[model samples]
Target: MNVAVEGRIEKRHISLSAKAKAYVALTKPRVIELLLVTTAPVMILAQNGIPDLWLVVATLVGGALSAGSAGAFNCYIDRDIDRVMKRTQGRPLVTGELTDREALVFAWVIGVASIVWLAIFANFLAAALSLVAILLYVFLYTVWLKRRTSQNIVWGGIAGCMPVLIGWAAVTHSLSWTPFILFGVVFLWTPPHYWPLSMKYRDEYKAANVPMLAVVRGRAVVGLQTILYAWATVACSLLLIPVAPMGIVYSVVALASGAWFIYETHRLYNRAIHGHEVKPMRVFHASISYLTLVFLAVAIDPLLPF
Candidate 1:
């Protein structure tokens, strides 16, 4: 009987671990990291230095829950297509690690928690923006656009830009040109940042019948669009210098990083047009680094002495 009891205890421990992993998987932690990266830097720039530490923590925790709720809902809504897509085949829903009903319930629980958390700690505006982010990502992007339009990620990217506004609002409890410019910077950057990743997994998207740009258009057109958006993203970054009166460090990093980003995007276009090997993921990863550098400079320039 003792041996049987120990065996039951071990099984229980294993079951709990599996459930823990499943819950974490629903959050899509990597995407949460990207969202939060953009958040804290904006808070820094908004405060013109480091903001209150607890305020930053509260905003970040609230934002994480909101973003995670969006991700969980996305997983639930897309589970059918996810089963077909090779890239998403390992997701918790697709793998049977979590039930659809459980995911849906978890989504609402965390989503509501995010709003309450933000309202109590941040402000109504930030909380409201968090609600908007969840709603936009879920209703506008996932339910409405993902399968219907090739330009889905373009317009859907608006949800991602909400973080900049949320971050800024967390500090000043107001709107300003700076956050709008940063919003534009992120809005324009998303397609270039995401399209290449989609390009890498184009077959999966095609198999899933989702209307990614790569599915509906050839590489030449996709590459051209990436370059155009790269130009716009860089242009928007420059606007912050004048709008915020950012100093030399930010200006230099913005120009340099933006130039590299544009060059890599142009290289993607050149390769696609010339029938050479196009390194799509290289451009994708570079775009992430570019944004990190630009935002880091945003946070730093505010604190630096000219």
Candidate 2:
């Protein structure tokens, strides 16, 4: 009888651990990590140096919560489509690891808590922008735009840009041209960044009845658009050099990384227009590296003497 009780207790513990892991998965921690990557560097730039360590910690925590909330809500709303797509088939809701009601409740709890946390620990403006980010991501992007148009990511990407503003607002508690330039860089970068992923998964998107650009348009056209957006993204990144009065490190890194990003886009375009096997994930991974390097420069520039 005691052996039976011990076995049941161990099983219960294992079940609880699995449930906790599923809850964390609902928040899409990878996406939150990318959002937080953009957030901290902006805070560093806004300070023109290191700000208070506590403030940085507070802002990062709030930003992570806010992004996590948005991601969780996205998972909940898209659970049906997620089930239909191969890439998303392992999501908690799709796997029945978490109920829809539980996911919805978790999203709301974190969403509200994020705003309140930012308000108390960061500032009102940071909190307000976080709220807007959540609304834009949940309503404008996920519900209203995603299924209706191929250009969904183009407009929905604004929500992703909000972290730069939130980061700046956390430090300075005000809006400025520099942060807006950073916002533009992200805005223009979104299409090229996301379209490559869509290209690789065009069939899945079509199967799921989602109108991603690669599904609705020919690969060549999508590639051309990616190239255009890539160029625009690089141009916008250069605007920061002048507007932010960026140092040599940022200026050089921005130019070099932006060029590499544009080159990758052109490579995609070449493969598409020529009817060669288009290895789009190359550009996709390249975009991630480019963004990380450029932003790393952003974080390092403010501390440089020159």
lDDT of 2 by residue, 1-306 (tens): 012474573322337788899989988888888788888899999999998989999999999889989999999999989999999999988877788988999999999999999999999999999999999999999999999999999999999999999999999999999999999988898999999999999999999999999999999999999999999998989899888889899999999998999999999999888999999999999988888888899999999999
Cα distance off (Å), candidate 1, residue 5: 26
Using all chains and alpha carbons, the TM-scores for the candidates as numbered come to 0.95, 0.95
Over 4 Å off in model 1, which ranges? Answer: 1-14
Model 2 pairs in collision: none
Report lDDT (Cα) of residue 93, candidate 2.
Answer: 88
Clashing pairs in 1: none
Instruction: Give the lowest summed-lDDT range of ten residues in model 2.
Output: 1-10
**What's model 2's lDDT at 110?**
91
lDDT, residue 272, model 1: 95
